[model samples]
Target: MTRPAAPSQFDDPWQAQVFALTVALSDAGHFPWTDWAQAFGATLKRHGANRALDGGADYFNAWLETLESLLEQRGLAGQAEARTIRAAWEQAYLSTPHGQPVKLPA
Candidate 1:
């Protein structure tokens, strides 16, 4: 018997972006993949994630949390930098016109 495939598509676009960012950062050697895997696993365990239901298994947020935690722990980037970047994106998203894509401020 074959195991079920993991769901690749996320319910939200930001979740997808967060998932991609983790892979890109790992590929670029910002952090070792093993470390990332550990971080992600630790986060899932902390959150008591139930991997069966779609809503229950919203792991993208966990992925983002893991990445942020590693950045803080490893000093690749700190919490302040993460906060600033996240805030900028939030502002850009709020400022964007309806039905238009968000763009970062110049």
Candidate 2:
């Protein structure tokens, strides 16, 4: 039997945002799609997520890692900056009141 189509919904907005950013950055020529595929595949393998176990859960996590790796490899963003950005997101998510949008620090 044919497999069912994968759902488009993400577990959270952050996952969706990561997915969007991957596409946007790739489109902007940070890396070609072939490079993207290799990075993403390596990330998935590293996470032992090559198989669609747990219903393909953690796919976006790998995507985020791949995005970061690509950005770092392409000299677009430093590792320190990535860590800072992650911390800023965590703080924004924690401090924002429920129902309010999280904002990056200016």
Leading candidate by lDDT: 2
Tens-digit lDDT track of model 2 for 11-95: 7898979888888887997778898998888887778744553423488877877787788878999788989998999999999
TM-scores vs. true structure, each candidate: 0.69, 0.72
Q: Mark the regions of model 2 whose C-alpha exceeds 4 Å error after superposition.
A: 1-8, 49-52, 93-101
Score candidate 2 by TM-score against the native.
Answer: 0.72
The C-alpha stretches of model 1 lying farther than 4 A from their native spots are 1-8, 49-57, 99-101
Root-mean-square deviation (CA) per prediction: 4.1, 3.2
Whole-model Cα lDDT per candidate?
A: 0.78, 0.80
Per-residue CA lDDT of model 1 for 1-106, tens digit only, reads 4444886457677787877887898899888899888878888887765544233345676777788888898898899988998899999999899899898888
What does the lDDT come to for candidate 2? 0.80
How many backbone clashes can be found in candidate 1? Answer: 0
